[model samples]
Target: MRIHVKLYATLRRYQPDLPRGAALLLAVPPGTTVNQVLQQLAIPDNVPLVTMVNSSVCRLDCVLAEGDTLNLFPPVAGG
Candidate 1:
């Protein structure tokens, strides 16, 4: 299966070489969960994340489907 992933804010460091706003095209096995992809990307478990699948909020355990778009964002803090 294949998916498109976009990293935002601090999470963008995970894939720095990609052009801004460009999706990281990934080839994953069928039934792969969001958590597995995070692990593969070496994103530390301690880092908080806001996950979205195809533009809707999703949990880390969400099962991904072919052509799904997964966007990852780190929580924002403001004064």
Candidate 2:
């Protein structure tokens, strides 16, 4: 299956060495969860992150769908 993944802020650093853009079209197997995608991208799940799918906010356990757009953002913090 293929899905679009977008990384923002610090999370963009998690993207693999490739063309820079608003998102990346990733090829993942069926049943690929957000957590699995994080691992595959070398992004630690333990790290604070905000994940969304198709415009709706979701958790790491969220199941992705073919052609879905997944966006990942690093949690914002301030002093």
Q: Against the true structure, what is each candidate's TM-score?
A: 0.95, 0.86
Q: What TM-score does prediction 2 earn?
A: 0.86
- Give per-residue CA lDDT, model 2, range 8-51, as digits (tens): 87777876575566688899999999988888888875888888
TM-score of candidate 1 on Cα atoms, chains taken together: 0.95
Question: All candidates' lDDT scores?
Answer: 0.95, 0.86
Model 1 misplaced stretches (Cα beyond 4 Å): none
The model with the greatest TM-score is: 1
For every candidate in turn, the CA RMSD to the true structure comes to 0.8, 1.7
CA shift at 51, candidate 1, in angstroms? 0.4
